[model samples]
Target: MKYGVLEAATAAAIIATSVSLLYTPPEPSWETEVVANDTYGKFVEVDSYGSNVGIAYVDSIDTGLRLAEKSYSTSITDFSAQRKGNWDTQVIDNRSETGMYPSLESKSGQPSISYQDGDLGNEKLYYANRQNGEWNRTEVDNVVGGGTSVGMYSSLNFHQSKPVIFYHSPSQGLKMAEKKQEWSKEILEDGQGWYTETSKCGNTIKVAYTGRNSEQLKIGEYDGGWSSENTSTKIKSDLDIDTDQRCDEQLAYLDTETEQITYKDQDSRTFGDAFFTRLALTSKGNTTHLVYHDEGTGLKYAKKKDGEWTTKTIKQGSETGEYNDIEIDHIGNIHTAYTSQKKVYHTVYNKGTTQKIQSKTDEVKIGLGLISALLLIFTAIRQEVIAKIIQKIGEIQR
Candidate 1:
């Protein structure tokens, strides 16, 4: 009877221990925070300027969606009021408007500001500087046709210690213009032929966009001259080629490590549901990190640590949202902002801690399950022994 009672108590204890282990609350972890309102738009740059960090976005305001700036520290402030409007607006208004707005580029070592002028066309580039809490605008490129259409893209690269702007004109293919000797030179004469997205890594320029007749993502390298390659093996019809296919591509580098490009391709009917591709290539002293986004899966990242594409998903599901802008700081920290359900959200990945925790949780769950099974087997053996003893005792008593 005593042996049976002890066995029963052991089983109860094992069951209770298993229940406690399984029901414990998960440890809290860092999660992406919704920093702004539910607005559909683009967040161009998050500049760590002045005494705090300033975020810039190009979205609809009173006179339609224009570029705006907001400053945040421990507190958030609308610095947009200090600026008249976005760079596009200033160019449209003939550069007469004043105040702080958004600019494609800012003069280095100056309080960042947006510039605009009437002499500039709809496609204009301006250099802005802030003096004594006020903004000064200067026209960097008076040339016409630099801006991309809505949902399209363009980029400015400070290559070889010179500012070069690469953009797609409506009918012109990919064009490269260098700001040298206070004069601009159109290097790529065959400008508007294929879709093009350009980014700079150190001194290397990486351009990726779709081809004129094919859906493949065409990539180009600019060292001394322009050399091109196709990153995607799929055909042109397999991808979603925009009206002006030349402008739909996106390109960016991962920190200062290496250049990478991410763009949309529609291989199947499932492709149109996915619109944006965020890619990053990072080289640790010389390592490459490639990250991309697909409609089927939200955010996918790849790394070249030992010299292969080691890929993983950062986020999954459409609920995570789309239209992501990724930036890697000097210290190799990644910050991404995207629109999910019409709301702007920001997420930062710090040294892969999130990845480590997820791995541990998976392993722990498996280990717990195995332990529970072992306990169950032991409990069964004990119960069987107890039953045998009880039977023997009854026999003896009879």
Candidate 2:
């Protein structure tokens, strides 16, 4: 005598109920802090050096460029990893409507920022560096006349210890400004250079940007000289680029037509799925990490290692991951800055298994394991009962 279909269905229902009652999802293993509040972080960039993390962002309330710096303790003995010492905020530039689209980098434990001036008739590019307890500002480039903007899409990096900035010019195309003695400028492409991102590997400085005419992806490499090439990939809203120690380029971009987050390396391999604009990317050796906004599921952190991609949601909200920036520290911790509801937030992911929080996928796996074990036991008991019934019947017949 075997179990009927209704009995099987009831057993499945019981197993499901048992799993639901017995298993609990682990808590998220990340911590977040509010860096700024109430429209202070419109456009942001984050960078880390040693134990210090710095964020540069546009404070829309004061219409200024702001810097937020915090130092984190890396000791895991006390479980006090999220103890980011008080975030100190400083006004880098507060003139009339400045500091839109800022790129920040930490050099020698100090923050250096490149930004766009938003004042009317002063759509200029500016750089600010902190030294001796004060900030020194320099005008890197400016529009000669009144009708054009020159620095909105600026990407800043250091090449040979000198600051090099790649920026967009509405009338002039893609341009680069290098600060050796005085700021010298050169035009890379005549009618291109939108949404530029820059990274350095030894003496090589690479920039990834969007072409103005075709709206496609383009790469500009600067070793001894500048050379430009076009890629078949199209750019939609935003993109980021980084380089590993091997000088291999790791790039992530928003696809023009699909609105998907597409990643590519020097070898031209691609990964990722549908996501919204404004992502940040960083790489170390064979591991690449990205933080992007998913239109359906909020903010996500994705990692690609050994040719496989594993992604997890960092925060869940409609507008959480917009305007995000990511950085990897020397010891392999991940730090990110993002904006949600017009406020800036900082989050960190520390490496190691010290934290016991499991992801949602892990919870599902645990539930499935429980169900499988229970189903095996139910089948084994049912078969034993059937064997006993047949034995009794055969004994009576004898």
Highest lDDT model number: 2
What is the per-residue lDDT of model 1 for residues 1-398, given as tens digits with 9 covering 90 to 100? Answer: 35564566566657655764665323322235554565434333443333223344433332212233332222112211112222221111222322112324333533343322222244444544456655555465434444432112345556776666554444455666665687364535343323344555555776655544444456666775778765534322111121112322232322111122323222111112334443333334333444445567675555544434455566676645344544443434345555556555555544333334445656766676666676677777877898999999999999
The C-alpha stretches of model 1 lying farther than 4 A from their native spots are 1-30, 42-55, 61-152, 181-195, 223-292, 296-320, 352-398
Deviation in Å, model 2, residue 193 alpha carbon: 1.0
What does the lDDT read for residue 323 in candidate 1?
47
For model 2, the superposed segments whose C-alpha errors exceed 4 Å read 1-28, 145-147, 266-276, 352-398
| Alpha-carbon local distance difference test for all models | 0.44, 0.79
State the lDDT of candidate 2 residue by residue for 1-398, as single tens digits. Answer: 79884478557857776676677543326778888888654688888766778888777845688888877664544233555358889889987678887889867877788988877666899989999868999998887831278787888888888888888887888888889889998888887888899988889998999877777888889875899788888888889988887777788888887778878875543434454569999887678888988886778888889878888888888878878999887766688899988888988876522333234435665677678667767777877888999999999999
